[model samples]
Target: MAAASELRSDHALMLAVRDGELDALGELFERHHRPLFGFLYKLTSDRSAAEDITQVVFQRMLKYRHTYRDDGSFTAWMYHLARRCAADHFRRSSQAPHATDPAGLAEHADDRPHAGQHAASRDDHALLRTALSRLEHDDREVLLLARFQELSFAEVADILGCSVGAAKVRAHRALHALRDIYFRLQNPSRASSLE
Candidate 1:
């Protein structure tokens, strides 16, 4: 179950948006845009395309304003829109397949020579990003939605068109896969930093 505060925030803004208040939508955008953009950036590995897709997702939200109901969580509905937008982008890009290389994957292990923990942090982020990118689209989608978007399993399932139990199972598997990739790339050294 969502916290009362979270539900209150999302629900209140959604109600305002429904009432023809553009600032409500702007507030929602300001609150969610960064994490959502980061989620898309990690998923597609294309910042420009992610920006385009985010715009498309919000535009579609405007188009479907009448369909939004206070009974449902706004995050879940927005994620559903994101999932569709990502799928559409993937479908279009599938026509021009590019070879996956381990070269960029090496960046995961590349820690800059520095004195402080900043380089360590950079490597850790790179490792997570590379590992995240390595996941299958479905797995990546669930992981990002759960970790980055901070959504519940039920919300993730609704967005992905899967059952809550299935979403939970997938999230577990995706986390495991991400861990495996992290260890395999560099070693167990970074694992401690991750936590």
Candidate 2:
């Protein structure tokens, strides 16, 4: 199982990456790329844009290696970088009338399966993505950092530059909002399974 895989802390991995260990970078990428891409793709609602931002975030990490602090967890630092990249990408795209075309949204939606062996709502994935996008940036960031990144509340607080109490509240609000949006999207009128 993926969870059963030997779990090395992000801090340990980054120290290696900082020392020019290419394999460490590969391991970090392999461990995080999917969930990070999913989180960004959902946040931006645009696959190509998310991909570009993710690459830029990683590149920026490499460029800013000298600035890394031993006192902080590398994962939190990387998450902060990604959150900034995603926020910037959203800001720019929102300013342009034709910033994100339908094709881009569709591509991002490709991250979700159209059908599945499990009976969970396939549409819920898309609905969840939409719900996540609707949240305030801080709320969304904390929730995604916790759920997708699997960061502890303390780590999320560090990445978000917020207090742990604030992170917990934000996560709660985001989850509540997600539940509301999910049920609304899967309203009983549209989904017989919801009843």
Candidate 3:
């Protein structure tokens, strides 16, 4: 026989929590906390803040368990809550999100066989992170949801509280914007001339 947890979908787990089976939330947390933290880390460019917000998100899940509904994806619902938590964190801090430090980017360096290639890749990643950080919060958010989080347009729309078409449009525009910023960061002389 399948274990109770193995038999339960994410929605089922969440629904169980909503119905006062609070321990079920542990399974959901085990399943989602890493990806949630990754999303928060990328969005905030601050590992400590991401860790803090991650805990708050779960606390919120417990506090707001009654709001869970059967009609939506639990992942989408979780991200919706995550977005609000991050926004609230930023608001309370009264500061704009910043780029990750170049040194910090080292933590994400690829484990390639070639040292030279790894260094180049690391630099490229740093540049991209900087470019992403330079984008407006909303643009960064849409890209994070659609690209980094790998959420479908439907789920992205659900989390963003928009129509699917609108979510796609936002993702499209955000990608174009990121591309422009990335290339500009790569070519400072050309960027200055074009400005």
Candidate 4:
């Protein structure tokens, strides 16, 4: 038999929330808040803004509970709402998102016995963040949703309001763009030749 927690899928919990069992929304929040915060943090590169947006996401989830359909995965629905909240934040602030500090990225890195290895890893992460920030917003968003968040292509498509095939193509193109940027950042001398 499955564990009680395992048996209670996000869909089920969200259904309960839709049915007015308000505490179920707390369970949903607990399950999703961290990854949602990470997604927002990566998108905005501002901890304070990410924190505010994360809270607003859950609030919107609760307010818009009735709109969630049983046929859809809760994760997709949540991300869709989150994307809208992020867009709204950008519209209100009229600011482009920036790259997060390499030090902040280092917080997530594993400790290594070798200082050189650790420094190399940090540098790579910084380069990656800069590359990601340089990407067009749509490209960055596709990569974040598909790779960082580990959503299925189908889920990404739903969040993006496109077909799964379209989602896959976007992810592929975004990944290639990121790879090019990362390489250029690593080898600036070679960048002009490649272009």
TM-score of each: 0.77, 0.74, 0.87, 0.86
Prediction-by-prediction clash tally: 0, 0, 0, 0
Off-target runs (Cα >4 Å) in candidate 1 are 1-8, 95-116, 187-195
Lowest lDDT block of 10, candidate 1: 95-104
Estimate the Cα RMSD of every predicted model relative to the unseen true structure.
7.1, 5.6, 3.1, 3.6
Scanning candidate 2 in windows of ten residues, the lowest lDDT window is: 95-104
TM-score of 3: 0.87
Model 1 TM-score, all chains together: 0.77
Please tell me which predicted candidate would have the highest lDDT against the true structure. Answer: 3
Better of 1 and 3 by TM-score: 3
Model 1 deviation from the true structure expressed as Cα RMSD, one decimal place? 7.1
Report the candidate with higher lDDT, 1 versus 4: 4
Per-residue alpha-carbon lDDT of model 2 for 1-195, expressed as tens digits? Answer: 554124667777777667776467667777677777877775665577778988888887777766678788877887888888877876876741122332345556235553543556644555666556656666666677888778999989888788999888889888897787567656866444432
lDDT of 4 by residue, 12-126 (tens): 9999889998888888888898889888878887778888999999999999999999798999999999999999999999987866555665443222345556778767877
lDDT of 1 by residue, 46-101 (tens): 66767888888888777777788878889899888887887798898783212234
Give, for candidate 4, the lowest lDDT window spanning 10 residues: 106-115
Model 1: per-residue Cα lDDT at residue 41 = 65
